[model samples]
Target: MFEALYQYQGQLLQGLTTTLIVAFGSFVVGFLIAAVLAPAAVYGNLLTRRIIMGYVGLIRGLPELLVIFLIFYGGTVLLTKLAGRYVEVDALTAGIASLSVVSAAYLTEILRSALLSVAQGQWEAALSLGFRRPRAFLLVVLQQMMVKALPGLTNQWLVILKESALVSVIGLEELMRKSVVAAGATHQPLAFYLAAAGFYVIITGISTLLLKAYETRLTPHMR
Candidate 1:
């Protein structure tokens, strides 16, 4: 069944590279956004908290595919108007931006919960030591929050890994798109499709194992 798949090895690998790039890019960007927004949501004034919560609610309620479409299409139009010429958003850029935005929403909630889990006494103790609020939060509280948030973030990474496939619809040439093309040309849909599924499973499986090990090391008492 995979006989014909052999010829497309290079293409499939290239597609897999794109898939990894999108997933990693989205996760890194999402983590950064969540790092900032999570604290603001937890520590900021009422209006700031409300605004951040509203954004989280809005993005979480929307479909991921819909977000991708809006960014991919809407971004092109907006950029074209701004540049006063034909400006098209790159598919890869759109994939990363949309997924990262969506991922950030969920990550913010995860991190917010983690942040809240931290004891108020920890902050007080840091302040007693003459450390500034930002320093205390960064050096002490944030570290604990990240440790608490690790499992949720790991699962979110897997979610984004799978979600990256949706970018195929926008022509980013990720694994799914490559499989479709290969199956259509080779007339072995099962072979190519199964291969794609297997690829995803392998990547997610490896990721889970690695993250779990890291989690264990981080929280040895829990283990």
Candidate 2:
């Protein structure tokens, strides 16, 4: 296994890079969408809240792979039809969109829970001092919610990272896909897969340390 890994070192690095790119793209986009979604679900009017809730419910009900297929293949069809021109989506674009949607559902819940965890007293205090509710929430509650949400969100981050492997089905040249190619070429399935798993372990291990450090910074009790 080790010899095979050494021989295919360049492929491993390339795969790692693509994996990170896909993960980063999905995570960033998902977090931004979730930031809006959580707040809208809580504070928006009944219709808006219901709409957001329905979206979350729908996503939760579906398998992740199904979601990816729907977005990738479905988007291509819809785009081509709507535009009256053939439109093809690249694997990366489809993968990012699919993963971001899944991540957003979890992130929305994490953020909403964090926001609700803040004391009502603080909200009232700000209102009593003449700050509008929205302004107060933004100025005070948002920061606290982010701090509280970080640990859970980071766990979700790792989930999305691992899930990116599923994009191999779409022909994305990410870590898993690269590993598959190498394994086929070298006839060392176990060795190549073990190497891929090790790469993921390294990424997650480093991420865990960073998350811990950030958590300690945000909440001293974590130390």
Candidate 3:
């Protein structure tokens, strides 16, 4: 087991790198999209609100693996149709796009919940103090909302990180995919998978601690 791990250390490290890249990229893109969509869902017109609601519902309803398959395969087909020839959607692109879509749904819910958690009275108080709607939201409401939102967002980040393993299905060569390959070749499935789990645990532990630190900074009184 140890020999196999030692021999494949380079491959494992490469997989880890790919995993981190996909997870971080997806999280950032998804969170930003959610940031915009959350406000729209919370404050936009009826048509806009309904559209956002439908998107969130659809995403949340599907499994991540299924979502990945659909995006990669469906996108390829759509591109082929548009170009009037067969087109291929690369694994990395499909993985990121699918992961982002799923993450965005959760992020939208988190942000909307945080925004609503900040009472209307706070907005009123800000306005009474001569702050405009935009300023009040940007300054007062956003500060409180972020403090409330951090924990949920961090949880979502962790979720995305783990869900990244699903990207291996489309041959992305992330950690899980590499582990599968190593397991097949070395005939040491348990050892290789255990190593993968260990890596995931380490990353999770570090992220959890970092998020806790950030949360304490955001809400010192709670600490």
Candidate 4:
């Protein structure tokens, strides 16, 4: 077990890098979409709110694995048809896109709640200061919403980290896939599996600590 891991340390590192790339890429993309849609769902007209909420609901209702499969295979088919040639979505692209969809849905709800938690007076105060709605929200409301949403966002990121393992099914040699191959090759499933678990724990632990520190720094008033 240890022997195999030690021998394949370089490959494992590459796998970890791939995992991080997928997780962080999706997280950022999802946050950007959520930052826009969350506000629309909260402040837009009935039709717009309905449309945003409906999307959120639909994405949340489906399983994450199913979403990955759809995006991976369906995207390939769609692209192939459009191009009139064989086109396939690589595992990394599909993984990021699918997870981004999943992340955006949850992030929207988290941000919507955070935005609501902000006092209406904050908006009024910004307006009184001669700030336009967009400027007010960006400068004032967004900061507070982020502070309020930090814990949820941290957890959501961890969720994304774990969900990235599902991408292995599509043949991306991410950490989980690498671990599986190592286990099979070494005939030491338990050792490699536990090692993989430890790797996940270490990454998630470090992320949680960093995010918490940032959260504390952002909300010093709460301290």
Among all candidates shown, the one with the greatest TM-score? 4
Candidate-wise lDDT, in order: 0.95, 0.91, 0.95, 0.95
Worst 10 residues of 2 by lDDT: 214-223
Question: Candidate 2 residues 1-223, lDDT tens each?
Answer: 7788889989889989999998989999999999999999888999998998888888988988999999999999999999999998889999999999998888888998998898888898889989998899889888889898998999998999999999989899999999999999899999999889999999999999999888888888656
The CA root-mean-square deviation of candidate 2, after full C-alpha superposition on the true structure, stands at 1.5
TM-score of 1: 0.96
Ten-residue segment with the worst summed lDDT in candidate 3? 214-223
- Which regions in candidate 1 have their CA more than 4 angstroms from the true location? none
Error of 3 at 139 (Å): 1.0
**CA shift at 122, candidate 3, in angstroms?**
1.5
Per-residue lDDT tens digits for candidate 4, residues 1-223, read: 5678798788778889999999999999999999999999998999999999999999999999999999999999999999999999988999999999999999999999999999999999999999999899999998999999999999999999999999999999999999889888889888878888999999999999999999999989889
The regions of model 4 sitting more than 4 angstroms off are none
Q: Root-mean-square deviation of each candidate, in angstroms?
A: 1.1, 1.5, 1.1, 0.9
State the weakest 10-residue window (summed lDDT) of model 1: 1-10
The digit string of per-residue lDDT tens for model 1 on 78-196 reads: 99999999899999999999999999999999999999999999999999999999999999898888889998999999999999999998999999999999999989999999989
Judged by lDDT relative to the true structure, which candidate is superior, 2 or 4? Answer: 4
